[model samples]
Target: MEVYHLYSGGKDSSLAAWILERMGYDVKLVTISFGLLDNWRHAKETAERLGFEHQVLYLPRDTLKKAAEMCIQDGHPNNAIQFIHERALEAVAKIADRISDGTRRDDRVPFLDLPKTRSLEDRFSVAYIRPLLGLGYKTIRELTEMLFIVKIRESEELQKADYEVELRYLLREKGIDPLGIFPRRHYQSRVLGWKTEETR
Candidate 1:
């Protein structure tokens, strides 16, 4: 079965690609570049290292700028980050449609939550598969090691940059993890602006 995997060059996505290939499925990799210097390099190297045919989708800067503005105007709880993420997903979904889906065209987008950002992009047509959800970061490391997969070296620009750490730092500054106020998926909300009410 032919399937297209969203390639982020992260441990999770890399491991997902490895697992899918081992399962006897024909998987192609697609990476969307939002013009982030660090992200572009990472995606390029990961695709080459794994020897998978990869394609790059360029995202316009204005799209991101507009998303950021919408977040601020709408009082999106997280700010500009979430907007960027949603825009990326939307861009990927559009690209995914252009690619032919052989067997897995019905695959669905896996979201940490049920709603909110669920429909930001259409993953079904791309046959998006989330094979790494059952696996943790440590397991991903072990698999890469066992399979001799080369770990992606972070660019010097991102050497000390950790988005999760940055998120917590801001939460600390705000004196709130805001769990009681937002849904679980919004754990990244501090980084991505979408906010969800717990009861909803």
Candidate 2:
């Protein structure tokens, strides 16, 4: 069976795709862009490096705008991000019978709880899978290290093509400084490619 993995060119998503592939599922990386930035190309490149078929899905721009507004209203990025993630899940459900993501067990934001996940499955007749939901930070990082090379940095330093980057852009367009809303210390990763023999 084929699984369309929502990819962000980050460590978690990359690792999730690898795990899914190892388990015998054909994994195709899909990056959702709300038409704010062309940064989704970062994920496309990383997907190629990882040897997974990849595509960019241009979604409704209103979804991005609403999430940005939610950030300003809520004074945090968590719920807004989760809202966007849920929307993405719903949209992808229409494209394939199976949808997957990199959301981890410990991740608080952009996650689907049991009830919500089940609801999505029931309503869309789709199988929602997040392979990393059972894996924590250390285990995921260790496993990623064995399979791929990644670049890690504070999110401010132009990290991977995660949604936050575009969300921050949209927030700024709405006259709200992202620094005023988003946490400053958050770090993210970008998967560069597979680890060659010498590096591994």
The lDDT of each candidate is 0.47, 0.89
Output the TM-score of candidate 2: 0.97
Best by lDDT: 2
What's the true lDDT of residue 65 in model 2? 88
lDDT of residue 189 for candidate 1: 8
> What TM-score would each prediction reach against the true structure?
0.54, 0.97
- Model 1 TM-score, all chains together: 0.54
Candidate 2, overall lDDT?
A: 0.89
Q: Give lDDT tens digits, candidate 2, residues 18-72.
A: 8899889998888999988999999999988878899988879988888888899
Clashing pairs in 1: 78-193, 79-193, 82-192, 82-193
Candidate No. with top TM-score: 2
Candidate 1 lDDT over 1-200, as tens digits, reads 76566665554556677677888877777665545334445555656777777776666856544544443354443444454445555666664542221111122332323353344324434434457655555665566555543333322223212122233334444564424332345311001111135311
